[model samples]
Target chain A: MQEIEELAARLRAFAEARDWEQFHTPKNLAMALAGETGELLAEFQWLTPEESATIMESPAGPRVRAELADVFSYLIRLADVLGVDLPQAAHAKIDENERRYDADAYRGSARKAPPLSGA
Target chain B: MQEIEELAARLRAFAEARDWEQFHTPKNLAMALAGETGELLAEFQWLTPEESATIMESPAGPRVRAELADVFSYLIRLADVLGVDLPQAAHAKIDENERRYDADAYRGSARKAPPLSGA
Candidate 1:
């Protein structure tokens, strides 16, 4: 979490130094994040599952890393601006997912567990 | 970084416990990451820039956090499976951005710097 905080600080300073904060509104950051996510997905477009697994070893590796970095930067900066703690939110979500999907019953299945009766 | 790495380990174990690793191919993860990114963007879809900035104090805040968590989870998992170190990649991109955009020259501008002559 410290690394994430530091990264957020750096992003803040970078934007402030350039007076870019006015342009980094949450809506803009969210849209930017989406754009980067699209770029990241484009890196894997048309690649077979097997090819995707080994993409890091291919000529596209550096580009993939750069795209991922772009996604992460916008995501982190958005979270920082919104006062969200990224790690804590993620951990809470994982806990919720564990409760939602019973491991023993859901083994080998990607399907969502059915809604509990009368819930 | 430890928090991210720990989250990745938890995600790996979660999938392993459910025998869902077979379903977690890189292509699938990338698509899932995109889906979550869309959900995150949806949280800000109808809000103006000012509304988006103050969203954290609104009722939509928790949902925004949850959507962000979803995006983070899939992204971390994707990077983990691809053997990319997320923080390092992000830091490198920030460094590149700093060099590419000179603060003094680009002050208050969001436009990207033009390509260097003749590379």
Candidate 2:
């Protein structure tokens, strides 16, 4: 938790020192996050499911990690700008999911939390 | 941090309880994360920049949060499957970015982490 807070502070300091907040409007930050997420997916796009899992053993490993880093960087920045406490928000989400993804109900499915058909 | 880890453990328990590890492979988890990210972006696809920021005030707010939760859910699962420590990885990325995004050199820009032109 301290690490996340500290990292956000450092990033905020960097942004403030240069006054980049004007450009870092919530929309722009969300756009950046979405773009990075796309980049992260691109690194896995052509690979077979097995290949994607083992990507770290291939030449694309570093590329994948770098993209993941980008995704995370933007995630933190977006939360900062929106005043969202990520850890708390994330916890609440999981708590919600606990009921949504009930082990007794959705245990064998790979489908996410979408409502069941005819439910 | 505890919450994140605890949520991961709970998710794992849910998966294990139903023997869904076969579908919880790293590749599959990453794919799910990517798909959710795309869904998140779609929520903002038609909005003007101003509209995007204030989406929470619009009817799309809950949808946006749900999508974000899905993104985070898969992200945590991906890291868990890969044996990656997300907090550490994120910290290292910020440190690396400190050099890459020198406020003195690259302020007022939103070009992401690409290399300089002709550098």
Candidate 3:
């Protein structure tokens, strides 16, 4: 796999080819990502519960898939700029989660945490 | 924020300290991410719609926050291994989205595509 930095370089090259650097500062990139996220959410805006669940698997999936790609793209860029190793961070976070949401208590329930102290 | 690869390196350092490489193959990492995603989804499960929306804003926010961190962690890892510059990818994808889900037809409705030609 290409390292994240290499990927960033490739992206820079692609952007340079198009003279798009002026548009890729962290703030603008972030704004673009938010806009794309909105579009991704919009894909399921009016759909029924069932439709929302299945939309990604349907012919219309392309649209939502594209939007999700948008989300990931910006997320990666954020990582690129910030120097975060996604895989390692992801793995480490899972380890932390194992502690907070032990499987024995968390399996098969939709609840996030155990009840509040009084409730 | 650090660059994605640097973050990966920092993560590697963290993992190495714990000798956790065996557990981080792409397959295992992916499974772990899915599991964590299930947990994040669980946070809102069983709660009334209002409860789910407010849960993140309440004391229980920490729990949901942790789960989200889990999701982003693995996602970053996957991107790291594959060498994708998330920020650039995100930016370009938004440009693509503008074409697919132009705002004029998409503003308030939740529908994805303009209705299918026949339906």
Candidate 4:
């Protein structure tokens, strides 16, 4: 996670150097993250399912990557503002998903998984 | 990145165990990533700017985290299918941005910076 931390530190420094912290509020970061995510999705909006698979190999790859990186940067910034350790939180949530998305019943189903037996 | 790699491995194994690999293509993962990102954004859709900042402390935090994890999982899956090294790609993008988004010229601006002066 050194790379993740380093990139985030660099972003923080960039914002701090510019005195942009006031605008670096979680609200703004989340909105920015959403906007970037929307941009990322837009790159695929007109693609066929097969074409979507090769987007990274297509002419749109650079733009797509730029949008993706933007999404990640905002996500990291949002997590930092909220005091969440992103990788740690991600690990915990994925662990829970392992239980919730058990393969025994969910395999081959494209539908949303129902909740487990108990709350 | 060990953690990211571990989660990807586990996800792969889960899919393999269920013979879901046929459905785990890059196209599907990209769409799923976009869908989860939209879900993450929806948590803050109606919040005022002030309210957006405290979402983690609000009742919606868990849902937000769950949606974030989903975004991450699908992103990882998509990159894996596309043969992209996500961390490296992100690092490279940030470095380029360090040059493109120079704080000296961009500070205090809420607007998009115009393209750099040269080709």
TM-score of chain A of 4: 0.90
**What is the Cα-based lDDT of residue B58 in candidate 2?**
82
Which 10 residues in a row give candidate 4 chain B its minimum summed lDDT? B110-119
Q: Which stretches in model 3 have alpha-carbon errors above 4 Å?
A: A1-119, B1-3, B114-119
Q: List model 2 lDDT by residue over A1-106, tens digit each.
A: 3655776787687677655776766676767777777777787777887887778889987777776766767777766766666666666665675566666777
Using TM-score, give the best candidate's number: 1
TM values, all candidates:
0.93, 0.82, 0.49, 0.84
The DockQ leader among the candidates is: 1
Instruction: State in Å the error of residue B119, model 2.
Output: 15
Q: What are the clashing pairs of model 2?
A: none
Backbone clash pairs for candidate 4 read: A1-B1
**Candidate 1 has which clashing residue pairs, if any?**
none
Q: Please give the DockQ score of every candidate, comma-separated.
A: 0.55, 0.41, 0.08, 0.40
lDDT of 1 by residue, A1-119 (tens): 48899999998998888888888889988988888888889989999999999999999999998988888888899999899999999899888888887888888866554211001
How do all the candidates rank in terms of DockQ, highest first? 1, 2, 4, 3
Error of 3 at A98 (Å): 13
Q: Candidate 4 on A7-95: residue-level lDDT in tens? A: 67867876776667777766666667766766777887888878877788899988776666676677777777777776666667657
Each prediction's whole-model lDDT (CA): 0.83, 0.67, 0.49, 0.67
What are the per-residue Cα lDDT tens digits for candidate 4 across B2-76?
655776686677667666677766655656676676777778778887887788888998877766666666666
